[model samples]
Target chain A: MVREIYQAVADGILVGGVYALMAVGLTLIFGVLDIINIAQGVLVVLGGYLSYSLSTRAHIDLFAGLLITIPAMFALGVVVHWAFIRRLRGAERTSMTLLVTYAVALIVEGVLYKIYGANNVQLSAPYTTASLHVAGFYLPWIYVYGFLLAVALVAAVYLLLYRSRFGRSVRATMANETAARLVGIDTGRVGALTFGIGVAVTAAGGMVFGATNAFNANSGYDLISRLLAIVILGGLGSIAGALAASVFMITLESVVTIWYPTWAIAVFYAALVGVLVIRPRGFFGRKEVRAQ
Target chain B: MIGERGAKAGGLVLLVAAAVAFPLAFPDPAVTNYGVFAMIFVTAASAWNVFSGYSGYISLGHAVFFGSGAYAMGIAARDWNITGAAVFELLPLCAAVGAAIAVPFGLIALRVRRHTFIVITIAIFFIFQLMAFNFSFTGGSAGLSSPFLTWQESVYDTRFYYIALACAAGAVALSWLVRRSSFGLRLRAIRDDEDRASGLGVRAMRVKLSAFAASAGLTATIGAVWFYYVNQVQPQTGFDPLFDLTVVLMTFLGGYGTIAGPVLGALLVEPGTLWLNTQPQLAGASEIVLGVVFLVVVLFVPRGIIPTGGEWIRRLR
Candidate 1:
């Protein structure tokens, strides 16, 4: 029983890493832009489809496909920002963005449905089925790889935010957009670039996710609900908070599933409410910084 | 001014009379079925508008209340052996169940900011959906059927149509009343600026909770009626988050926070979607069109039709 519990926890941590990777993009966009990307889930699914097509048609490795999908997704993000998101202004921008992004989600979902015909598909590779034996426990290779990739990407994001010049501008914008603009940060450029970078990370997350779980276009709805819960629990715009919350939630869900499979999903959300009641701003959220 | 007021009152009376007589005028089963769905959506949208439209706390989880009401009716009919007249008797119980769920849901969810609140609602909604899928009493994913209403096929659609119309009218009237009350002012103040409202001695939490509860109850009542109308309840059909989104979109498309907005939105969107559904070539076209319309409306007419039209009229005058 103890061994099975340990396995569940181990499996959860690996899956949680991928969740963190997906959530980081959402938090990054919220931190800098003050807009919740309701379309983030669909974007992740789009990344998965991109990877799926490349792996199947071009015979590219799942990890190697990111090289192409990342840039493509980034460009898509930039176009979306430039076309629809750029025009939003004034006090109602936050709520308006929610509706606009939802519209974006619908359009993308419609396109995916039109092409894919509502069938569940997954990215397949030898690694997807292989497991590593470590200390009398079997660890899936895709999960291990996914966790490592998530860690590397998260570290890369941290370095980009804290160690690079562009990172400095992003932080400045996140801190105070008006001040960033006054300092000649070209806040609009920063917003667009940050949104692009945020979306780009979904390629890695999506590849890992699709490899593990079968997904259709409609899967984005469930994915968005889960991702939103993770980010909210992590403190909407806090990167580290997203990371911590992801692992915590996934672990809790796995643990609950071991004992009470029926209530596992409910427990995940129940924990969110329980945590928020004690700390409404979330784990790493600043109290005064209301989502405007 | 008096003439304008009289004209407005006359228009309202005429509108009500028209609405009450609609099913009679068009007794075709197809038309009545469409009317039933339209009225149900309008009621749900109005219920959504009462809380989200006024308080700026957009709930993506209203399907929870809606599904709860539906499940309540389903369980009562199936488990408790309630049938025929007893099925109608379960309406209040279903509504109370909705309000009951809303109390705890609102307590937990209302503590967060609007953005976070939206996330919480989504989370809770998924939780309910998952529960519905897992719990055998609710019949799991296979779902439960209401006690088959023995109404004749000829009058069945008409009967449900009137019930739906009544529900919609009650919901709209409730929304209209709320909008004109001090509670409505408090909700609007919270939407404008929560900190400022609270600073001015408004009990933001209580006001929001009451509105949320009221909205849930009304929505659940409609959901119960819908369950009976459809005679079946599935997790996918009952707690579909997309249903919540559609209602929200309808409210927004018509004009969030206005009395006529949700009604107008339902009028436009419901039939439009039904028409799209009927077109054999356009299987998924409605969502795409709705998406484009949503983007355009948010970008160009964020204040919605009524307010924007009112502005246009003022400009012309």
Candidate 2:
């Protein structure tokens, strides 16, 4: 029984890493732009589609395809942020951007529907179905790879934020946009680029999502709901908080699913409400910096 | 220039008259079938306007209340043996159910940020839908049928049309009253700035919760009427996201913050949707159209169709 519980936790952590990767971009965009990109979920779909295209058409491996798709997605994100997000300003910016991103989401969903129809497509590879016997439990290779990728990318994001000049500028801007601008930082440029990078990470997350599950254009609807919940529970703008919250929530969900699958999904949502009720600031949320 | 109040009143009178006459004049049964859906949508959009347009808390999950109302009416008719023939019995039950469903859903996400509120709304909508789908008594995905209305009765469609029309008119009139009342003013203030409203001694949370409840009740009444008209209620059919988006679209398309907006939105968007749904090629394209309209409205005319219509009306005057 204890072993099974341990396995569930382990399995949950692995799945949660990939979720954290998907949610990190969502949180990052909110952190910088103060706009919840409703399209983030769709962008992840776009990433999966890109991988789908690459693996099926160009004969690239799913993981290797990220090498090309990440940059492609980043450029797409940059253009989107430049064209649409940069124009939004003022007090109503957050709500207004919801409409804007929703529009973007629709446009993407439409195009995907036009191409892919309503059918669910799953990514296939040798390792996709391959499971390794680890400590009396079967662990899927895709989950392990996906978790490693998430951890590595998260580390890279940390390095970029703490060690690089661009990261320094981003942190400065996040802390105080006007003050960052006063210090010779190009806040506009940082914001747009950061927004792009945030979206670009979804490429990795999306590949894993597509591999693990069959997805149609409508999949983003479910993905976004979960991502939004994770980010909000983690503290909207906090990366570390997103990681912790993602693991905690998903683990709870996965463990519960073993006992009662019906209540499993509801448990995560119930946890979000419970946490918020007790500590609205979330587990690692910074003091005095409300989600607003 | 036409004052906002005068324009709203004038538009309301004209709309009610037109709605009444159109159904009554529809000599063709097929044409009135179209009217029924349009009327129901107008009611839902008007109810959506209460919290989203006026209070500025855009709820993407309004389908929860709508679905609850649908299920309530469905269960009432199926289990209680309540006749859909009676309007008064069903309408109040629907309204009460809608309010009950929305109050807690509202409380769940009331204190959250704007986007988070949207997320919660969508989540609750799906939760309600899934719960309904899994429950056997509600007929799950197949949806429960309305208590058998007499098909042999010649006035079935005509009577259903009246119910839908009445529900739409009530939703519009109630929205107008709520918009003009002090409660509406307080909601508008919160919409503009919650912090400022709180600073000014307005109980922002309380005002929002009440608006949310009222909105839910209004929409749910229509759902009950809708169930009667359609004769069935499926979880997915009732709690569709596209319908929720359509309401948001119509509300914005007509004018978000105005009493005339939802009416204008329904008048404009519903017909186009019904017309488009007729085409097999454009079957799924309505969503695309709505998305495009959402973008255009936000970018070009953030105020909405009614406010813009008021502009044209003022010019003519």
Most lDDT-accurate candidate: 1
Q: Which stretches of candidate 2 lie over 4 Å from their true place?
A: A286-292, B1-12, B151-155, B309-317
lDDT of 2 by residue, A116-168 (tens): 88999999999999998976888899999999999999999889998999999
For residue B213, what is the lDDT in candidate 2?
A: 93
Best by DockQ: 1
Residue A104 accuracy (lDDT) in model 2:
86
B1-317, model 1: which lDDT tens digit per residue?
Answer: 99989998998899889888988999899988888899999999999999999999999989999999999989878887877856888888988999999999999999988888888998889889998999889999899887877899999998888888888999899999999999999999999999989999999999999999999999899999999888898999999877887897888788889999999899888988888899989897777887898898888888888889889998999
DockQ of 2: 0.49
Per-prediction DockQ, in order? 0.67, 0.49
User: What is the C-alpha lDDT profile of model 1 across A1-292, one tens digit per residue?
Assistant: 9999999999999999999999999999999998889999988998999999999999999999999999999998899999989899987788889889999999999888888878899999999999999999999999999999999999999999999999999999999999999989999999999999988988888889899999988888878887888998899889999999999999889988998988888898888888889998889986645434
Model 1: residues >4 Å from true position, as ranges?
A288-292
lDDT of 2 at B13: 85
